[model samples]
Target: MVVMMSPFKGQTGFKRILNATGYSLAGLRAAFTGEAAFRQLLLINLVLVPLAFFLDVSRVERALMVAVCVLALIVELLNSAVEAAIDRISLELHPLSKNAKDMGSAAQFTALCLIGLVWAIILLG
Candidate 1:
């Protein structure tokens, strides 16, 4: 028996960076193309990043807000990727695919909740 490896396996540092960039771009494109919620979230970020500067927030609070927003975007991107992969595999409904998609959605929801919590604490405290 012979073991076969993937053709695209073992990426170097530059390749890793390129792959990440590709994924990020793909996620952004998918968000813009397919997900209205992601678009809304992005618009909210656009407002909040500048608002952070205007507010009398401490450096740490600003950092936290930035981190939370970035995390939310990252998670949403990952969720979009997962969904795309699942759909690519099959458009037909499957329990495992549903589970995977649901889990990805849950991850995004968790990230959104964290972002909300961070903003609430920083702005309201």
Candidate 2:
């Protein structure tokens, strides 16, 4: 007879949540240590989070603003990861590496523009 063991057998819901939260915090720390753009976005979030509360925005507008900020940060994090991996594979300059880095930078630029557009629409419309 084979006994099946649950992966989360000993963990309560709250404990699992806390564990996941801690892991996320660690990831953010790693990103900040390794990525300059992540640090900039984090600083932006620090300012925007307080501004969101004071703007007297509607629930939907506030949610949209927060979502866009988070999305931009996420994209920047991915771009940084890609650049790091490319650098790890080869320290020498390569066309593909240049292309990858350029594309990643473009992606971050696009995300920033989207955040601005969303905020403008929400605030003006």
Candidate 3:
């Protein structure tokens, strides 16, 4: 029997972890420079995270507030990656591609909503 390996999956162990970290950083750079939505969400985070620290909320509430902000950024990163992957596959308009992109957008939207809901409850309740 014969098996095939992905050329991109060559790294292993500690070296793989280092390479993965570098790749993740590069992806973050790319998203920061190229993706407007990511930048917007990051700006929002910059405001919300620090505000969380200053607020009179309990430690857990502050953490929850900051966590939701981070969650939104994570979701935006994922959504951008999905859009980039779909574009890399092909620019042609197709239903599957449209659906994939739309779903990614929806996920980001939901994350943003979660951020708002969590913050409101923690701040106002």
Candidate 4:
């Protein structure tokens, strides 16, 4: 048997850490520049995270509120990645591709709902 590996996966140790960090930053930049939904979520995070600090909530509540906002960004990133990958595979319409993209959108929708629920509970309850 033979194993195949990506040439880009060969880095190890400190060099790998540096390369991974660069790649991660690039991914973030790409999302921020290319994905409208990501930019919108980021704007929301800019508002909500700082607002979390000014609220009179306990530390744990503040953390929870900030966390949900961050979670939405993370979900949006994953959703964007999924859509990009699917588009890369094929731009032509296919049922499976549509399903995959739809599932990713649904995941982001759920994350957004979670943010609303968490913020509402913390601010009102």
What's model 3's lDDT at 105? 96
lDDT of 1 by residue, 1-125 (tens): 99898887778799889998997787688788898778888887898778878889999999898888888877887788889899999999999999999999899899889988998998899
lDDT per residue for candidate 3 within 1-125, as digits (tens), equals 88999999999999999999999999999999999999999999999999999999999999999999999999999999999999999999999999999999999999999999999998789
Candidate 3: the clashing residue pairs are none
**C-alpha local distance difference test of each model:** 0.87, 0.88, 0.95, 0.95
Ranking by TM-score: 4, 3, 1, 2
Task: List clashing residue pairs in candidate 2.
Answer: none
**Which has the better lDDT: candidate 2, or candidate 4?**
4
Residue 122 of model 4 has an lDDT of 80
Q: What TM-score does each of the candidates earn?
A: 0.79, 0.77, 0.93, 0.95
Kindly list the per-residue Cα lDDT of model 2 for residues 7-92, writing each as its tens digit. Answer: 76666799988988987898788899977779989999899867887887898889888988989999988898888899999989
Q: Looking at model 2, which ten-residue stretch has the lowest summed lDDT? A: 7-16
Task: Show model 4 residue runs off by greater than 4 Å.
Answer: 1-4
Displacement of the residue 117 alpha carbon in candidate 1, Å: 0.7
**CA displacement after TM-score superposition, residue 6 of candidate 4 (Å):** 3.3
